[model samples]
Target: MAEPILTVKNLSKSYGEQQVLHDINFSLQKGEVMTMLGPSGIGKSTLLRCLNGLEDFQTGELVFEGQTVKADNANWQQLRQKIGMVFQSYDLFPNMTVLQNITLAPVKVQKKSKAEAEQAARQLLKRVQLSDYANSYPRELSGGQKQRIAIARALAMHPDLMLFDEVTASLDPEMVRSVLDLIKELSEQDNMTMIIVTHEMNFARQIADQVLFLDQGTILEQTAGKDFFTNPQTQRAKDFLASMDF
Candidate 1:
């Protein structure tokens, strides 16, 4: 395998006296879709935050493309440009039209020309099947549409990697599948490395190349999606899969 695009070693984090993650180690190669599966409150989101430099870690190393990420790392903004994230909540600008929201960051931060940004944003919206809703405000769109626009906004940055933290967790049941389908398409079409933290085990089984089973802030098992789901080696993973009835 090639050298990993993201390398995390002995990554640990805490809140005051409580440690949320402990000695976490993982590496993600370019174009790999790695899913982290765990119960709630297991520090899955915390780990993702640390990976993208959102949360500060007191110990260990997070390296993106060979550059180490630390609490006071000065290159964060530069690094973050290549790593995009989408959250469970659709954090759209309520006042901006969908197209504006999608192009805002690229135009303002990346210095993309308005015409260029609009062209790219429109293409992304089309990819997410929301080309018709460009003029709609966030409030005017359904939960799924808002999420797709959020994804389009992320892609507008032209990131090399994407981190999705339960991106569909806030959507209605009917809307969830639409967003998932879009993500599934991303896994098929984009070469972007992805670290997805989600409870959607069925989607994980289908889209993930590798699965990491996390428990109590530790990675219990790391295996390919097929082997991990079909024949999990750890008792914790087996228990988790049993509880989910997978």
Candidate 2:
């Protein structure tokens, strides 16, 4: 059997005196898609942030491609190269053009030459269907366009795993489909490994290879996608699907 590319063991996180995540455990093999579904204010977003090292945990560890990094002594800089994360806020540099924003990491962090990075960035832009927007600034594009550029920017790094934290949460309803469709394509065509936190039930149903249903900082159910949406194992999961009108 092929080994999982990522694994989290007894991952617990807290804020000051309050705990938000408790003993979280899961694994993701290469080219698999796992969607995290939960009620708002649950630990979903926080968990994603922890995985990307935006927030450090007091306990537990993450193993990526066989290297174990304990939360207490983590240096995610190296791991960041292989793990791409996209936030709902479209955290692009407002001053830089789309091309520059997409190529910055490749050039600075990866130490690729300008010409090489730009060439690869252009290809990513085309892949994201925003080739025409390459020279435009982030301020000029619509929400969906900016999100696409964000995805392009992440892909320019050729990450082995992608983490999306409600990338469509801030978009207008009409613009949400475009971004979601792009993500679906990344799974189907590029075969990217991903962990997505989303509220779009139908999209999750279509794209998730597996489902992680979180509630009150704990995993209520971790089941196959079809089983999760259709025959949720736990009452909390069933109630969650009901609330989403799935």
Q: After superposition, how far is residue 151 of candidate 1 from its true place, in Å?
A: 0.7
Clashing pairs in 1: none
Clashes of each: 0, 0
lDDT of 1 by residue, 70-175 (tens): 5565677777789999999889999899999988989898898999999998899888888899898999999888888888899889898999999989888899
Residue 56, candidate 2: C-alpha displacement in angstroms:
0.9
Question: Per-residue alpha-carbon lDDT of model 2 for 130-170, expressed as tens digits?
Answer: 88988999999999999999998999889999999999999
Clashing pairs in 2: none
Q: Would you give me the overall lDDT of model 2?
A: 0.91
Q: Output candidate 1 Cα RMSD.
A: 1.2
